[model samples]
Target: MSGGFKDAKKDGSDPAGTSMSNGHMGIREISAGVAGGKWSAYEITEMYIDKIKSMDDRIGAFLTICEESARAQAKAVDEKIRSGKQPGKLAGVPVAVKDNICTDGIRTTCASRMLENFVPPYNAAVIEKLINEDAVIVGKTNMDEFAMGSSTENSAFRITKNPRDVTRVPGGSSGGSAAAVAAGMVPVSLGSDTGGSIRQPDAFCGIVGLKPTYGLVSRYGLIAFGSSLDQIGPMSKTVEDCALMLEAIQGRDDRDSTSYRGEYQQDYAGRLSGDIKGLKIAVLKEYFTDGLENEIASSLNESIRRLEGLETSVDEVSLPAAGDGLSAYYIISSAEASSNLARYDSIRYGYRPKEYADVDELMEKSRSEAFGTEVKRRIMLGTYALSSGYYDAYYKRAQKYRKLLRSQLAGVFEKYDLILGPTSPVLPFKIGERSGDPLQMYLADIYTIIVNLAGLPAISVPCGFSRDGLPIGLQLIGPHYGEQVLLQAAYALEQDLKLGL
Candidate 1:
């Protein structure tokens, strides 16, 4: 299929009664078909369930499949339509949620053993919003343990393979969410990005992923990794689907203190006019430095040329503070993680050891036995950084650097409508390629971490492919709360590129 579900008939006609199962259909087509009575929501849900059952064993994208609940949701949607009632925006579309986003009664594991069996009593704000829109939650996708690693190999359960290349990683810790959309298991999925968790994985899997401005979406029930840096976003097969999902989930919530209280555009998808003429886009010169792969660099250059052809002005700019983003992000995020994860002692609701000498040993052994290596490593690093003498030297310095980076990015936005760059410096690598080296794995997110550090909006869209057929992605970053223009520009480029999965 071409970009934006071009093959699907717009007259709401069902071709051969199997278009719902076609894997290439976009969100609007499926929802509209179900609402218009051209197709039943049950049929759409069943087709997606069947696809997941047949493909998930090989892909390892989902940790749990809520077949029973999904069917119940689909039937409810069909009943609502039959009663002559108007359905919500995402009427009958099936959505896969990252395991970290709590769904009431559906075990939210966060792909970590510590909370492997922990069932949340409440739904995350995003989950409640999605369900309110009538979206069906198909299952919870896997991720790195507590979202600590670059490759999904760090998951205590199983590694998520890239749908484009099984031998390669799908990127993490949102790899499973990206793979689910890439493999067509679902039209869209939710993933949390602390430092490139969402965009890096989307780039690897050849899909669209958006990290909304911090506080655009509520974080009430998300398992905190880096409380300040983490933001929940949508991963989808196309940019239109991404925008639709974002519109469904974004709003002000009284429960989350950090939730954005400012008013903004509501219909993100409806605002896609594809008219980005005279848009000034700045290219970060530091992003094109040494470690970038040749194919990705070439793909980014071509994408820039495409934007130029669209009458948008493209110019190279430098942000020296961006070069130090990785260091600051790790320190700040890890320190937050260390504090957030401290509540998981044996005395709490999570995993607990049967044997312990005392309360001290219970907490110690519980963490030691349940936490993965990467989680432990980060906790230690964060604990050290937050320690007495070293606090100023490390964590404090990182915070100062973060402020400088945000200031520099804000300056760029004053002159440019958006910033463009490669989503990842390297292509999707083999599963075990960099897992053994922590520093190397951290470097994989060099191009993406700065967006999170600044708490700005950014998206990764498929640009082209490598010679070996691996998908390459280009990133488009917008000013805080500028998702409208950001998405319009991305949708225009996506229509121009016409790259199909």
Candidate 2:
């Protein structure tokens, strides 16, 4: 919990066996330094690599470290700078990608035994975009197996400990990426959000995370979870870094049918003036209900006060259907997961049973052996929902709820520019505290799942800490494709509150 970049020693030395000076630099500083010949990209990359090697044992954020490739890329960036050629916007910045995102020639394990050795033949669309921007991918971080869990405990390889509290979970699916940024192993990282995967972890880890509107960022190479809900997003130490990362990765990709065809703002970072005057925000009453911790609720109220000080209007709004989001999300996401994960049967390229007597037995043994318990549970639930004579009762009803929730949210957006709430109802829980209870684990995402269900853009920014000093996150939900205003408002609040993480 105490070994992040902020804990660097006075002598410019890091406890993690790297230079703390460079480690303290943000994404913009690193890229600017490398491009201006103030430092080589190799130096920044090496510093981060050393930090990861020394600190990751406690955090367990990384599943695979691409040391050789990262070094090569850094050296290439240095050469480009020396030749007086223009490097891309993110030149020399180090990034960690979630394992579910494909990286060419690098293993893309979803932290599951199935496809444990699956090295991707091509880069994910976001990965390609980052690489094009001269961003160095240091490694792939761990995640909940197949992006199916609310906490990192479901990972087959290892549990990612919270960087703020080592005994606590960092939050899930994208826990590794969140932990990596929170621990200062990398300046920025990528995470996929199906429900609350990205925002919850960002809240737990005390950092910045943004889940763009569905299809705003391409999902061509990201391993599918809920095809409709899944979105790859940025997690970073600051809001500006999050905006920079988003700008680099957001665009239309011809390969993905779901990619947004409309135009997007090119200068996301440049738009961060921290000016929220006249912005109208609605506080979702449903999010401030019984399960929310008192400390978090107080923190959100304080954030509202600050927003109001900035000349923004804040009002309580009701979206009654949001209470049903969790149920509908489970049904729809699990159903999609059941279909997307079917491609991993032993007969194709995933895990294969060694001693099966028949094809059916082989598949049965393969999946049963390779998949984690949560994944199996969801698959069974989805299969049952999609089964004959049951689709209308469960799957179809879930779709109806989703429509109602989206419509309600859209109505609110018509009156307000953004919606505000606590990212998680509680602080980061101790490892294994909720693992025994699946329903309790699911409830942790109650506030975040609705955003994904509505396919809206949302961000989780560090607002304050609990009495126990655990970080609390404030979530801002924007209308569809309203990332520009969303980031602007989040930046305004982030600067005004100044938690100083």
Candidate 3:
């Protein structure tokens, strides 16, 4: 089995089917192989590099491929092992980062033309962690422009295809990161979730995606969208891989005021006992109601039964305010976005118009030319919400509703250890299915917005598949800073199913 390599087929292109075992190679397997001298760090890195170069064409998961830099990084890890020195837990593993996260000297476009040529002078906090752990920086994956849209189709660069079915859409904003892991281009990748960007893509692409509690992962070098809502997380093919990646990046950063400084540390991966015999899990009644596809409902019901068979105490819970979460999320996120995006007015940085009659025209031309349609729509909505006349009526009301939803979720979490539901309300649709209708596109994140609003941690893991062979995801949402419990429960289900690995 060519775990991360291909023998070069008749057309000189590697088919997506060629993989090591189970059609995917995980971070743990690669790290162990490199650590034990079974394979050099350089060899492991090169295998993925080769596979990505040969296979990424069909998937379009990456916007920038860091070939030379990645080779240099792998060589340094190889030297460390050759010198009989200690290596980091993730030594020699190849991982991709979402484009919105900055990497010093690498162009971080955020899948928007406005910053197409903007390269940060310093790395995002998460990139530093990946480097410290000796992980190879494979490249930056594509994303929805400024992480705004639900489908990657909103990307100004290109649309990322689902690895399972090329004709279908991969769930967005973080679709590129999810597709990279799903297609075997990389074992694990980093993604940001504001409103199901990470978990929804994981569900669509058949992988594991974890959105850590807000402030648990630093956001300094992550380009702001909705400042209060954006949280970076890990996307991988297995639950154990997600835990390992999460442990590497979660911590406080002096640069980010929102970052948390917890008491000591916990073994996020080592604590995985895969024992949930007495875990208290609740199924949200609101998530199972209208608009959920029949197939997804059936799959989720089966997943609940599987958990019950493990002796977990499962019950139904309701957070009525959650029904209003989508509306509130859009209002709040767009309002925050309007303020955050003011920096791109063509004065100091970002795209500038080639010709303009005056300062006003320059700003207008630059923005009109650089920003995409969806981005423009949100900016307008956000601006209107924050405007003087409508501030109290729109933004204030949304904030109040957001607080109500958060408090409701907090009450539910106090009673149950975790909340279980479908990661997405439906399966992956056609690429252009909802692009023309913003309301329908926003509904794609209906099941996920409340978690971000509440500042809690959540994960999406492959539980089953639709009749069309597309994947279905089961979501496990935990209270603020409750990732350990979420991972344990998710690990139990993943182990029982042996999915996607």
Candidate 4:
């Protein structure tokens, strides 16, 4: 992998088509460059905006470009810095937000026609935090409608192609966010995970994504999908940038009861000692199953050896129930989605039908006309699961299974510092390859969904690449509230594997 990057650099072509320097620059470098007068805030912002305008046509990563607002915010940061005042940690660094996350006055279409014109009244808690830190919100990236699908193909707007291979998918529902960062459109972006939405996309895009422990970041103003499962997290070009993004957004919020309220850890990037010596890391034997790709398996073995070289003791562990994650997650998340998505009845704020016989007819017509095929399918599945007699057989049973899976993971954490696995079961598939097969698309997230199910912190870091040149990801999952350890392990791995980008 290191040799591949070096060879690519020699040709001035990176894996994602950006120059080597652009692909490798993370939040720290960009922020420092802006703050030290290397470039003005507005200048940096214009660079990304121009890059997006020029490059995103091929990638389809961004849904809405906030050029005016971004320039205004960048000017403000520049003014603050020129006045001899601190402009915050993220001063002038351009960042993107997943379209599902509410951005006041900006249209946050979750890649669904239902809310294509919807403008959120307030910023998501994370968005507000990013603004306070002086991070420029360049635009909103595309995503699966309501964050339901594993592949960005489910998006109603446009499919976000993989920057690594334009024909292949960038993974979803955070595919657009990952693609933006991977293509060097921005240094960092915010994404939501409800069953591997963030981590899987990061894996496919060959970048770093962190799914904070459930409640580690606020969900307020983040349009709900699976309420219990959805969480806001950071997607960045490097582990250090991911840590900085997490540090900026993670904290308590009065509006969100689920937000972590107790004394919390800060300066996450600052705390990375990069010493994983003697760290007890367990490899899930179930992850390397029949469905797993041979290249990914080989890559995992090589990455484990690298960790072993760093003095980390790796052992194989079996979680017999781990294979059941996909089924259980679909059921549980669908049940919650049915309840959460009920608000778009056309009577309130979403798209309303031009003609309808009654209120109920209006709601039905609007939803039927606006919702995409995938969103409608989930709504039906969820509605059926919550129906009269099927509740106990499906949704309730899935909850029980979820609890058992969480317990299985909790028990593993007691004996190990982290559990490691391949983030996705297979390599990135070509766009439209799995569009006709929902089951196959769901299985792409087989290894990552369990982490979200257990409400644990996990990160997907670039480990290696496939024979076809796509990036492979190494997933490191930690115990609840164990983000510090997760970032430390990931940083150590990223430092060791000098993939350049």
Candidate 5:
């Protein structure tokens, strides 16, 4: 923890004494701070530094805080602001990137020891956008190693505790970003959702999470897990804030092979301005499978009624292979993980153990000591799936099922504008609740993986709360290239629900 980190439970709020402006101000406040000379970018940066240093000991959201680089950038933004030039839409805004996204000059650990000391010489595509937009990179957040787990407990350094309840888990891979935004450490952050990393935690913390269409955002610098599934997105306290970040970072990045062609119109806020009269919405009945908790089921039902009240016709649709989402996700992702991670040898660019004299010994020692158990397990499983004898049984079969899942989603999209469902089958569990049980933890992601598998877009908006006070999230899944529809529907539903920004 840094010296400037402030404890939320102890200091409560605004260590920098920055005042709150009705939640609507969100990203707008960064401009207000600069315009009024109320706080320099340096001061705002220091304030978050103080907050993170204080709260991280408990929340453990960040894997590493780029203090020097952040301070330096903030100082420059302050100079630009003082010079009477627009620092950009996100002037002085502090954003946290999930660890899997590469950041130049900083260790991109991915919350795994395997790349503990690995510092890339170049920034990821998203990093370039944030910097170009004058957003200060606060730090890299903790995540499930290679995004292999649901709860952040799989992280090598520490698990991200939910900001709402410290005893519970923050949803994984993007947990650190989700928790950071929810706890108000930073107004907005970016998280990757291969399954529900962004959405689930957004639900857990009562925030907005958007999983854009697979190619809507470039994946050039994001470490690959499931190449077909992973998509990076914004997590924020409000829809506008989410839109602000998304508009800045999204669009065509030619560097990424999968990047969308031409300009994909960078106006999400405009899309949100759509009137929601007579829009068709579908609630996937398959989402309410046997394992969902009673409370989440009820909360989702209420959210559907709220949509119906807004003049949107809501009906039930079934995605037959939705139940197989988790199964297919694990197999495909793990196989890809096995292949993607093969480059982390001690030979170059990653943690190398000093105790070994021979090549084989060095590689073995480095990986064995640096990599966590869950990562190793996936590596093994992935390797097995891709192995000669079992390739067809595991890897190929999983791909076929993935095709089935995507086709099923396509069929649903033919009738409805969006599919509504639970982001997670239940609310976040205890911190150590699913630690020892891999299968159970994997099940927590069952509801989310299908979206990733289908390469569609989804958002998790706070719908209601459980009897125990935990928040329930309703996921809005849309067809490929459905970012506009997803945002419009989410914005309208959010307005109707009126559950705080």
Candidate 6:
């Protein structure tokens, strides 16, 4: 907490109305700096390098920091800008990408030793967007290897520490992205949320994280784990930054067959009117039930009550089937993961261990030695689910539940503009607290995994804090492709709490 908000220094003279958050400079400030010739892409890159060099050792948030590639890209952007060319919207912005994303020529390990030296020859679509947008790729932040765990401790590279309290876990599989932004090493980070990865960590770190509607953002070249649930989205210090970054990356891409065809909600920034008069909001009773700590629930309500002033109405709603989302989500995700990861066989990519006399020996040893515990656990679960006889019981039933889950969400959407709840049942725990029992760790994702199953858009904003100093977040779930409603509601609370506006 050495520097947060920094008193929102958006004084009268500042046209950008930008706050001095060491966390990030929004697209506005970066664009303004580029326009006024105050900051070049090269300078922004240097700032991030300086921040990373000074802060990374304490945080352990990054799996790999591609310093040279970033600096070279920044230099090229500066050359373009100096030549009187419009360098695109991001101009001179610094963006940190999740390691799960593929970047040409960089080892895009998902923090698994299996892909420890796997350098992709192609960039993920989202990475291409950032580069084309003139945004500098600061580096690849760490994650739960293959995006499987709730806490980043599953990362084989290193556990990402919460920037707010180093003792606590930063939620994952996007923990490094959240920690980097929370630590003020970069302005924004891109994370792939197969479940709560982005939003949960943003909550843990008191930053803003947006999981754009599935299909709203392209998944081309994203290293797959739960392909149906995975989504690439923005993580930043403010909702505005989230929206700006989302705007730049969202669009239809032929590479992804499920990609949205003009389904993105527009005028997102314009819709942040700080007025939610008459918007119907639902508070899920189950979310505030047993496991959620009292302080976390109270903070959720604090944000809910503030929304009441905007003429919004809140009501309790029952989502009985939601309890199954966690179970079904695991089944389906792991099932898909089993199929997705089959590509990592020694023949094509990743670590190919010593030469075993037989194929089975080689496969078993390479996997056993390369994959982490959580990764192995999921892979086994997934393999079993997708295995011959049990596929109907586990995999097929999960799909049935997935359909039911979608129906349930649509039913809720019929009655409410947004469904509100705690992003996680409790604030983050110490890094090693729940590692002994994997199931206990999985339970923390109870509130979030459902949204991914339903493929609806959601955002987790810092509504308040616990007396113990842990941050609490209120998650706003909107109908499919309903970023406008989600962001508008979040913006109102932001303006009201004055948390980080």
Q: Of the candidates shown, which would achieve the greatest lDDT relative to the real structure?
A: 2
Lowest-lDDT window of 10 residues in candidate 2?
Answer: 11-20
387-474: candidate 2 lDDT, tens digit per residue: 9999999999999999888899989988999999999998999998999999999899899999999999999999998989899999
Predicted candidate 1 versus true structure: per-residue lDDT over 1-501, tens digit per residue: 332232322322322222223437788988988889867888778777877877888889999999999999999989998999999889889999999999999999989889989999999999999988889999999999998877788999998999889999999999999999888778899999999999999999999999999999999999999988999999998889999999999999999899998996788898787688999999999899888999999999999999999999999999999877888888998899999999988675888888999999999999999999999989999999999999999999999998999999999999999999999999999989999999999999898899988999999999999999999989999999999888999999998988856
Query: Residue 257, candidate 2: how far off, in angstroms?
Result: 0.5
What's the distance in Å from true for residue 426, model 2? 1.2
Instruction: Evaluate residue 32 in candidate 5 and report its C-alpha lDDT on the 0 to 100 scale.
Output: 68
Superposed on all Cα atoms, the candidates' RMSDs to the truth, in angstroms, are: 3.5, 2.8, 2.0, 3.5, 3.6, 3.9
TM-score of 2: 0.96
lDDT, candidate 3, 375-460, per-residue tens: 99999999999999999999999999988888888899888999999998889999888899999999999999999988999999
> What digit string (tens of lDDT, one per residue) describes model 5 on residues 76-149?
88888778887777878889889999998899988878788888889989889888888899988988887878
Number of clashing residue pairs in every model?
0, 0, 1, 0, 7, 0
lDDT of 3: 0.88
Off by over 4 Å in 3: 1-20
Q: Local distance difference test, per candidate?
A: 0.89, 0.90, 0.88, 0.88, 0.81, 0.84
Estimate the TM-score of every prediction.
Answer: 0.96, 0.96, 0.96, 0.96, 0.93, 0.94
- Choose 1 or 6, whichever is better by lDDT: 1
Model 6 lDDT per residue over 103-202, tens place: 9998899999999999999999998998898888888988998998888888887888998899999988899999888877777899999989988888
Looking at model 5, report the run of 10 residues with the lowest lDDT sum.
Answer: 16-25
In model 5, which regions exceed 4 Å deviation? 1-25, 35-39
**What overall lDDT, based on C-alpha atoms, would model 2 receive against the true structure?**
0.90
The CA lDDT at 491 in model 4 is 93
Pull out the clashing pairs in model 4.
Answer: none
Error of 6 at 250 (Å): 0.6
Better of 2 and 3 by lDDT: 2
User: Model 5: what TM-score?
Assistant: 0.93
